[model samples]
Target: MSRTTVLPVTRRATIVGAAVVLAVVALSGCAGTSGSAPEARQSPSKSQSSQSSQSSSPSSAERTPAPTKTTDAAAAATDLTFEDGAALSASTLPAFGLEVSALDGWEQTGEDSSVGSREYTKSDGSVATITQQRITDLDPSMGDRAATEQLFTAAGMPAEQLEEQLLPTMTGGTAQFLSIAGHTTDGSWSATVARAFAKPGAALIVKVQTPSQETLRPDLHDILVHAQVVLT
Candidate 1:
């Protein structure tokens, strides 16, 4: 005779036993919708491109005369898919004028412009979201990180759960990837790796909730090595 035991999964259990998924319901586009709709094609339709351009492209008054430091590149590329082992750096971060890359076996799961942030999944089901926010109310007196914490508060990250870390200035000519982990005021758990640029008033943020920091380190390392940002 053989006997087996199964334990129920609890919230705390998930922090270590399973991959983490922290859905940001209050923040629009933080967690994009996932329907039975077929996966997005590598090549977006021309109409879709035109529509996206019309909607997101800034007007003459809004357009920057020149790209800022963190700006990835002037032109956008196609089929720039991010996979587990590969690295990417392109004009992909239009909002924050930056670029981001992560190592590990992760595949993007969903992205809806109206919803904002893109989502990704790991082999173990760990999930992460990438999004950007441009800010203008920065106070240099507070310094880069303190100013960033203020922005974090406004974006809905609670104070208690915040764990801030300093990012390096470069990675063989790439901007450094830094992170913060925290829970929302409402108690939802999340962690985001962010890079802030003061010159142009924008911050590129990537928040992921995994079983633990250990689990996401590899990907974060990849991001740090390849991430690029030019705030001004």
Candidate 2:
């Protein structure tokens, strides 16, 4: 029998073993790469959670509202109205007692008349007011003249004296009278006549305002002539 070559068989077996080792190593490397893929996907989910938290919070400036301003119409709507022949007495008025009669061609327009002050509005848009108080009520140290001036100023008609005269009263007495020229709260030129009456520990003031001295002089004269003042 011919002898077989032992070296050739050995060489073939060695090559086959080397190929199997390389195949095993390649399969292990592929499995490791696939397991690490989930970690990369988890990084994107963490980033999305952080973004959602930042978007939900609001700043202080975005949550607050702006302030609004007041209008003239709103101020006018709050003014109170009065009826004709409304009266005020020492019990209701702060310092003096008086009764106001309804004047022809004028309408009473304010609630203050029921509590010691009277406001009137004429058809031509003229305004007048009669207010009375003790001299001490205006200022503890003020006299009748100074208090009268202060009253004019407080009523939005700061006085510039035009004349001083004697006003005839229904009780057959004379009251001190003053004619004044000034500007109203709306800056329009105004004329006013004021009368001061003496009482027991108090003084009564009757003031009428108009666009001109001639406009309400007759009304002023009539009001002063018939006004009754009780010494109490």
Candidate 3:
């Protein structure tokens, strides 16, 4: 079986009050193409940055072309595999009514009000999402609850067998935190952590899904916590 992959994410805040659960489905939440390195590209970190880039190049067959010298034109760099470590670009999401200043080299999309999500990416590559949807009622399924069920079902687990905890957020509020750790159907080790919060009218959520890393959970939680609520 193919290795379980945590597809990149880029979303906005959107949810209502619903029961929270723990589960993981396919990484289809954000809905978009992921960033891929350009074909036959070299990493600056490994390249000498100077003259002959021999050691950094691929084998002769993979690097060279026919020896015929013909008048050919040059084309612009097609593969965007090279990353220069640029800073994240700041952006404002009018739908979610928030601004993101921490993003470095990330861009935004999904501006339609109905979607109301601000998706971010770096160098045209997806990293994470701040998906937002207008919340009008109390539906736990809209936040962590919904995320847990969907993800758990996707991975085919006992959705009812997970644990839920009250988590603190940077927004000066509390969120229901839920997580699941087990082997995927393919038998690869996996884990998921999701946090959900609510205010006067919005149901907020932040989910960082990948193989088995616990580093970004708190950071994603705080991001939603501190999001300046401008919804009306």
Candidate 4:
């Protein structure tokens, strides 16, 4: 008869326990891999955060807009008014029926001897003369530019540079101011002339003579600015 051989019970149990333990270890390794997969996916979030930070910052090419520039002529046009400036003394020119003023440091001279003209001299040797005449032949339809040219021509003065100025009068009128700058007829000295028309049929002429235009321009401008037209 053939007989079957059997192993010990403890030894069989030990082998089964080892198999179970190996299966648990394999499942633990799989769980660890699954948890680490979420961590790996988080790397994209960090990369996106870095990109977002870079986009929020200002670029190197960005700049603020610059301010506009204000010119002297433009400033004079807007800032100069009838009320504000240096103190002045008023004198009426009876020939033109208009009033004129001289600023401080200017003394009136050549009173009646000039015949419808008044002369003013400053301590610095700057000279200003004011004259008036009935210009019956002056055509008002030709505009101030033409009148200025005609006046300069008649006075034998060259109008190298002609600029229009706006002078406000106390009588609520705006006189047309034509400013001319050039050397005299003989080219001996630089001079500036301002022709102002406060009324029709007459013209008020102011001539300023100096060694150079630079030295005379300020005084000429000031005199023109302070001129008051009082029609009596």
Error of 4 at 208 (Å): 1.0
By lDDT, the better pick of 1 and 3 is 1
Off by over 4 Å in 2: 1-102, 113-115, 135-162, 185-189, 194-201, 211-216
* Candidate 1 local lDDT, 1-232, one digit each (tens): 3222111111110001111233232221122212321121112233654565568644545444434443333222111211100222322232322232323467768763433456667785467665555454544344444545555555554434444332322211123223344333433444565544343344556666555445444444433332233222
Ranking by lDDT: 4, 1, 2, 3
Of 1 and 3, the candidate ranking higher by TM-score: 1
Q: Give a tens-digit lDDT track for model 3, residues 10-119.
A: 34444322222334432221112112211111112223332223444344345323223311110111111112001101121112223354333445544434544444
TM-score leaderboard ranking: 4, 1, 2, 3
lDDT of each: 0.38, 0.34, 0.32, 0.38
Model 3 scores worst on lDDT over the 10 consecutive residues at 71-80
RMSD of each: 18.0, 51.2, 19.7, 47.5
**Candidate 4: where is the Cα deviation over 4 Å?**
1-102, 112-115, 139-145, 157-160, 185-190, 196-199
TM-score, candidate number 2? 0.41
* Number of the predicted model whose TM-score against the real structure is largest: 4
Q: After superposition, how far is residue 144 of candidate 2 from its true place, in Å?
A: 4.3
lDDT of 4 by residue, 24-137 (tens): 111111111121111001011335434643675233233222224422222222112212111111121212222333256777776533234567777777777666554556
